[model samples]
Target: MLVSKSAIAAVLALSCLVLVKPQVADAQAQRARGASAAAISYEEKKRQTSDIAVTIVTSGITCTCARFAEDIRDIVNDLRPDGLRVLPVLGVGGLQTLEDVLFLKGIDMGVVDEDNLRLLKKRDPALFANIEQRVHYITRLYNNEFHVVARKEFKTFEDLKGKKVSFNLKNSQTEVTADAIFGMLKIDVERLNYDNNEAMKKLREGEIAAMIVVSGAPQSALSRFRKEDGVHFLALDERSLPNHDLGAVFDNYLRARLTHEQYPALIPEGTSVPTVANRALLVAYNWPESSPRYQRLAKFVESFFDRIYQFHDGSRHPKWKEINLAADVPGWNRFKPAADWLARHKGALQSRDGRTLADLRPAFDQFVANYTASTGKKALSPRETEKLFIDFTKFLESQVTSQSTR
Candidate 1:
């Protein structure tokens, strides 16, 4: 209780120091929280900006093209690679899909039949001049089998000469392919235009002798038909058709068979019907390499190719099994970014010698050169060569990647 003035001053100063220390600490903590919040906001903005959302135009609701598009959309969404989002739009068909990708604003890609390129060229040569250079394929999808269903009276394409036939709607894949096939064979049938259902009714009513449906095998529309309906698939004899000139309409069409296995109720057991098929292609407009759109698309390509196995695992559409990512689409070029990605990974995929894809380019080129020199025949086209190179690379990747994983 006996305190001096210096002791009293010392006690007051100590109290002041204790009170101010907590205030200063609280202020510092508040500033730290503010700085952390700002850093988090910046990161979120960067991530959103880096995300890619693209729309792919596909065929109408009933088409396998649309189903394939939806499957891709789901797979890409599931993978969620860097926020990649795929939007599949339903268009009229292949031609519309092409027009959407080419002319429509904000459209990134389309699912089109390879034959549509030829049809576009023939229909509007001026409009489609250098079209191949404008539109590029990402990958080749499944084949569309050409189905020529006829009345029992018409056994072969020749027997139905001068008879009325429906090629679905005008500018459709069936119409384009049927016209070209008929023109090539000199079989002049009175061409009629009708929807698939209407054409089916007409065929049953004897209004049309035959109808053509160009779609993937086991077409849903045709599956509804009963064997007692008296309709049969006409055999497209490749032998009857003249030798096709390279890069012609006949060139893209492959010889395919329709068997009872595919249509048990319609086709008899152990019987097969011969027909032609055209491939569907996933094509994109050639955006400039320097543009943001191109970069975004390139990201999508890498994600798609890297996870392609998911599409073929039987969970997706059955048509996915037919997809050959490296298949060649004659007369069309590949998207630069996609082609470059494939090329860069080619060596790693195929060679056990630790070489990059670029390292194997010279050997691939030499092989082509040697083959042409030895056989005295025309060499593979640039697209064909790229396809073979990719195929070989894929084979190598399977062996090497599988072993490494094990």
Candidate 2:
């Protein structure tokens, strides 16, 4: 009680110190709690790492589907910050990829031959009854030509009747299509299941009459295959078939050509080999819109469609030029996200029926030139040139408008 001024001041300071200590401690404890809550758990860390990743299971490396996947991996992956990561998984080719799509865990997408689904429906209707609901397509990617390589002596597919022919690996796309096609054509051949290399070897030795390979033109395995070995791609023109009827074959397959440019060794210059082709599909699971998976897939569709045109500019794959972003795939429902995208940006790149203006400019120019020449006009007049250019742009715009309206 008998305190000097300094003593009283010291006592006051001590009292203040005592009161502030708990406040400092409470602030430190609150900060520590906040830090603890902010720290991410391992499971959540795993999810954040995995959420951006989408695994696309495709056919063998030799198959064009894999080539397409590699293109996606090269272009889609590595987008910094906000971009998606595409992981390409190489799988057994043909319909097997379909199984992977429907059954395998962590497979976000697959590249499957469209006919594979049809074959599945045919083989077991009950098993795949709800397949259409479960699976959906992003787009019809490209066509895989059905190649029938045979010795020079075997001029037509019929000549190989009752002869040994390799149908590639059993249950492979080649075999599945070959089996269905041959059976439809009513041609009976001694069926053999061999991979492309083995089939080519046997074909060279005349052990087999022909080997069927159903894949994109200039398929990696066949591109290097020597024509000097006396084997060539047999013309699968409608006329070559028994009764000249390809109506049945056209049920699921489209008429396509193997051009000389694609396979310089297999096809002659300025000539093309006529063949039937099965369309390859980029398919995904039918994820609901409310799910996180759907958001991820939608991100993919937007990013891919946005960057798709670059793929045609000669950097990615030659097959990219063949992709028609607006092309409708028969019998397969497009993924809701992909469909919604197309609906919003209809004819975003395509002009007429899936052919883009870039794809038609050359042909259109040639037609104009030929028309002028036929009319005895040596060159397009200044007025004509301007008119043609306007018309060209107008035509593409008109197509885009027409599609968007519908």
lDDT values of the candidates? 0.75, 0.77
How many residue pairs clash in each candidate at the backbone level? 2, 0
The collision pairs in model 2 are: none
Per-prediction TM-score, please? 0.70, 0.75
Can you write out model 1's per-residue Cα lDDT over 49-68, one digit (the tens) per residue?
44667778876566778788
Q: Give the candidate number with the greatest lDDT.
A: 2
lDDT of 1 at 133: 86
Backbone clash tally (model 1): 2
Cα error, residue 20 of model 2, in Å, equals: 46
